[model samples]
Target: MLPPLKALPVFEAVARLNSFSRAATELNVSQSAISHQIRVLEDYLGESLFQRQGRYLALTQEGKNYLDVVSSSLSHIARASNQIRGEEDTKIRIAVYSSFAVCWLMPRLSDLQHKHPNLDITITMTHGSPELSDKTADCFITTDTEKRGFEYQLLYKETLFPVCSHAFYEQIKNTLNVTSDELSKRLKDEPELLENFPLITSNGIYNEYTEDWRSWFLERGIPLSNNIKFHKFSHLILAYEAAKYSLGIALVNDYMFSDKDTHSALVRLPSHRIYTNDHFFFSYKTSRRNETAIKALKQWILNEASSLNTLA
Candidate 1:
């Protein structure tokens, strides 16, 4: 038999927060009620779950062990309850950066809707890397590598390559009598050949300032030349435009190119493609990973990511 199942939430809340008053506030009950519920659990278990130390509460050894089981069991119960209530009726709120929304996600959303007609998703666009918390949104597509309570599934690592306008692409072809594939091979034979043209890159888009260019050159053991003409833009989109309009070659990410085949003016140089530690991930709460709504969304995102990566 269950030992006062009604008190589980109150116990979990108080144990997690380590404060009876905070748990009472969270559970929307009086502090006395919180005490009564905890006392009921202690009476049932015949063991102290928490010990007080100067103005704060700490979980005992038994409480620590019990918390792990309690948390998992409660999560399972919550997920099951949501499933019974038709979780699909609620929209899954996903937060992403604006650039991703514009360059990658927007194009593929139609396909997603067609494929999973029942899966409802609402997008929230953020300017910078989103500050994720319980209140932020249901899921996040971000470059944040930090592991929190959330489960992060890497969508793709950012692939850095150079691109230029058709006119510039032709000029390079005429001048060198070779395509980018050939040029990439030639660069390995003579690294100095890299200095022949202007280079464009963006600022503040990576972990370090202009790590895109640095990483590309560093990966190939090519020394960064100080004499190379550099055109710096405040953002990657501006740099992409610079490269699109015959503004020499720009170091760009795969997402910026989205579907490279579609861009007539833009030509990808596909140089030893530098895959960076910087990645875009599909993240959600781990506790809800098993819920049907979350499972469907996770599978859809994984499928889409696989398709996009394969196409790229």
Candidate 2:
């Protein structure tokens, strides 16, 4: 007995083009192979599926009925196969700004892992404008307000302040107690302190979108100086650690500090609260919304964000 499945490719191609030679060319097989498959299919069905006229082939009544079923089934199989392959190989790359990665997301990553042990997450530290459409990241976690066609989930509204290590603070306590102005002057003049301390500057390159050390100091009514010496590390976490090790006082987001790490030390400097309300969102390609992985991601992010009271 001949199998219907074995002849489906030949049948489908011939049905589509209405010619045996054309079907053979499309399937990348010899014309004789196409003829043999069709003959086998016809014998199995006990009916002539196509009517030959000159060199052309036309579907008979039986052929038309079979073509409808076979074509629909083949299309469905193709779609299913593609979906399965996409799910296995697909990566959900998320681009996040430095400070947020260190202070907000990194601490909470365990929660995501507990919920989705098998899901793959690719995190890249990108400064300002993750460029979602350009395929830089599947999702962007940014402070930007104008994100279109993305499923925006507000992770947290950040509050920024000064933080330094306990050991670093102890070394400067007598000096800091003199007066706020005197301490500020000392910090500005001390080149070694600045060099050792990760100043916790947000942007590697200055962009209008990024929050800067000068902006934060200006907001606090402190004047900017040319003599202030500090090393610039591109990402927020590196800066955070530099401060944690007593390198220098870093004006950083409050969100990056973890209460649980015994070795991790951070103390907020005496400054007024610096608050910024920005939302982070998960965005997928619009065409990919229906895919299983995309759907899974959307639901997972929504659920996690909701519990944290960060979802918008």
Candidate 3:
């Protein structure tokens, strides 16, 4: 009860491009071949799909509906096939936040590779949360949030603090004519001194626990003033970078600055830290928990997390 699967691809290409000639070129087929395939599909369906207007073509109402279904189905099939192929080759696909990918995960990736040279890992950076039902990635590293039907392991709980470049810290120290210890004590006692400098924070409304400047100040019972200068960035990584370049002081998490390289660039303010309820978690489908590659990755990630916990 199916039309030719071969013709379906040709029909979809023509419907998407709105031109048989262009679809033929894209598919590396002759225009006549494309026309024949479309005609065959239309005959099988017993309905015209496209409305012809001189040299141009447009989808009919029925064509639009069919195209939607066909496109989604084709894409799902392709993804499923690729996932199976990847699994056979011992590949692990990880979906993680863009900021974590750049700041935390990428820096530590060489360790993973050194430990498991045969394991092929693919990283997909996303701004939004991962969809576990989609089976898009074998694993996802994300902030703690309520979800059901997936196996998850805690990576680390993050602590927030105000951070700036060493140059900026020296500038503040010199301006106050205080030693490093004195500067720390003074900043702790007079937290309001932070308002004198340019502040950097995320423009995204992630969550209350995201540790933006407003939340950081509110946690300390010091109300942030509306008149204070701020440089808002679309992503946390950008804010972190701006702070590193001494553009402004940024509210950042402990994990992002954990590495010696990052810590060398930035210094956390003394005695001003906020602990977040949200923790980083490594999640995977329950069905895949026992798969060899998944199991290996899970163990490795847990070991890394345990080491971080010990250090913390």
Candidate 4:
């Protein structure tokens, strides 16, 4: 009762390209083969779909109408076929903050891959909170702001502090001709010590609660003057990288600075830890909580977090 499905693709290719020869070249068939299929399709519909002007081709009104339906149908078929073959099942999509992905999750991904060799994991990074309603990702690692329809598991809370490269710290100590303890004491007691250095801060957009430089300084009772030299970065990850290379001091959360390689390169300033109320959480749709891939990824993340806690 239906037109031949095989001829539709050939006809679509010819109609879209406006050249039977070009369509044959694209589809890896002969020009005569393309013409034959188009004729077969035209016979089935009882209509002339193309107007031939010597070597050129143009779609008739009916051709245009049929193309709209045929293209949409083919796309739907391809999607459904891929879905039926389990192409979508093997992937675990995770949404997370850009800074957390760069500084924390990326480093630990190798361990995850080693454990689950066949699993395909995809990462989507965001600066602010991602939309839960879009169904873009299977799970999210985000700050503990509640989403109404999602279930959350608390990962850990973070402590904020100033971090800088060892080279920069040594430069300050040598320049002041003081011991490490004295250098730390001076940093805490003398606001001028902080004022003398180039301070790095995140751009005041995205998540304002966690990334505000002015709030961090004000919380420690230190005044932030407009005249002080400051370097601003779009994301905390960029600021962290800059701090690692001795460019400037960056205010970072504990989790971002926890990697052994990162810790070796940087030192947290003394007497300046601020424990935040914002905890990190792993969240997913309550309805999809039982999905096998989602469950596996969730348990892996929890295990990784547990190891970090043990090491801490």
Candidate 5:
């Protein structure tokens, strides 16, 4: 027997988005209307589809299995409708870190536009890793490797290093009396040099507390000073900006420091790079993996990440 066709859209939207209010907004209906349709669908299926815990909504195991079928079938139906109506543009929404969007993806976005004029993109910048749900975005630039019912493409491995403003670099480059490569070696070998400047830190790196500097120092066999001065910021971007203004040397990574931005203002101290278990992956729901918008963006982003990873 066929499920209630009309109720399926309501269930899919509520399930994918994980919010009755948001599903109502997307469906242009009332929240009560969403709940009613969900009840109807669950009753027809003779099983519970959603588990409610206070203000949050989550899918049951059966609900998750059913959604894979429903979302894919609905997408194909919508694709057929778009084709019949001669639709030209497809919008792809992405969730990414604020720093990566500014430093890497922003400048190169136009190139993606040039390559695929029929594709529209919307970006939702995030401070930390967001949960994998349609409400987060249709696509995610995330470090999460869990693949329950999602597809992933490896973007780049996490690479850690420190940077200071070119202004700050000039002040110490001659004092150190060493080539850039040799300076990097010194930064790794000479822990005492840190006494000359303060360390800028961020809690946003790898969702850990001040591990950015700690990892770089420990990874390079340099010990953190007991009495070193430190400055902290809420986000990695803030720390990067502070470094650009010569506030101090901020521990950063290649993902945060890209060649495409106005990065000439910053100097890379490549003495040591801490590579962690973290690696960025471009992820999307497996059911929608074949969508034109998702396919195009995945290929272009993979190419871009490949170029940089190859260079490094």
Candidate 6:
């Protein structure tokens, strides 16, 4: 029969520390208690595990061999127990793209919590693609449609639109008197609207296919300017906040505007619309697809997507 795990920990601690009193100090137990536990453990094993030296205890040959196996087994048990407890406690680790987290997921997260009250979801931000090999997170929220090594479900697709704050409109609503092309050019020249205002950018998220202010203006048949100043952001939501506060106009994707209140504060600029293939997707390691918690979340996300599509 295997030895009790409780005894093995005390024995391992005493063996590593090489002094029962020191081990007791570390474990917050009396030296006599530590010595008694070790004695019980050695008796149970039917071996003298320690040899008396000048003023200390040394591991016997049997003790050395047993220590090698027992130490490893005990450490493994501790880690596994912690993991099981975490799962039982309904703790979940999730990795989300910063842009999606701020603009879309965060506002809707309470819905998930309300349904799964026991679930504790902790999120970490990924700059672009998350490292799948790390397993730091059990799930990831991404925009890529490509098939990964994990089970995946599409959350939502997004389209692009021009949005500006109420303050921005109040300042440039007079420019609306000109032709759409002329208005874009004139508005592009406003220091508050164009020069001083920060343009939220997706530097890493869409570096290969960056959405540029000049492209947005040129789409309206206006000449791209050389004097215009622009700024970029790693996450799109940061840009949304800047735009919401009248920092400047942002070519926000539709999914980012999750709130009716935020939507009402901004007006879509004239003749401005763009299409992109970006969409939110949830993914998990393929081996974990059958896990109870993963299956639960998967079903909920799919049901939500289906309902959203039906409404659309």
Q: Give the number of the best model, judged by TM-score.
A: 5
Which regions of candidate 3 deviate over 4 angstroms? 1-89, 144-147, 205-211, 259-263, 307-312
Tell me the tens digit of each residue's lDDT in model 3 across 1-312.
977899888887898788899999999999999989888888999889999989968988988878866865675566467678884446778998888788778877899899988888898988877765433577898774566757889988776678899899888788788999998888888888888888887854344322377777887798887778888788788889999999978887756776345436898777577666667889986756766667888888788667554434
Q: Which residue pairs collide in model 4, if any?
A: none
Per-prediction TM-score to the true structure, in the order listed: 0.65, 0.52, 0.70, 0.65, 0.78, 0.58
lDDT at 212 for candidate 3?
A: 73
State the displacement of the C-alpha of residue 117, model 2, in Å, after optimal TM-score superposition. Answer: 2.7
Instruction: Name the runs in model 4 displaced over 4 angstroms.
Output: 1-89, 188-192, 204-211, 259-263, 275-277, 307-312
* Candidate 2 lDDT for residue 265: 77
Better of 1 and 5 by lDDT: 5
Task: Give the alpha carbon lDDT tens digit for every residue of 1-312 in model 4.
Answer: 989888988987887778888899999999899889999999999999999989868999999888866864664465467667876555778998887788779988999899987779999998787765323477899774667768888787766678889899887778788899898788787745666777887762335423455666677677666666778777777878889899878888766776455336888776465665667788887766766677889998888776444323
Query: For each candidate, how many residue pairs have backbone atoms clashing (under 3 Å)?
Result: 0, 4, 0, 0, 0, 1
Model 1 alpha-carbon drift over 4 Å, by segment: 1-87, 145-147, 177-185, 207-210, 258-265, 307-312
TM-score of 6: 0.58
Q: Quote the positional error of residue 262 for candidate 5 in Å.
A: 7.4
lDDT of 3 at 12: 78
Residue-level lDDT of model 2, residues 168-275, one tens digit each, is: 766565644645466566655542333333355545434432355666666656655656656566666677788888777776654565434466578665544455
Candidate 2: residue pairs that collide: 103-255, 103-256, 197-247, 197-248
Q: By descending lDDT, how would the candidates be arranged?
A: 5, 3, 1, 4, 6, 2
TM-score of 1: 0.65
Best-to-worst TM-score order? 5, 3, 1, 4, 6, 2
- lDDT score, residue 294, model 3? 78
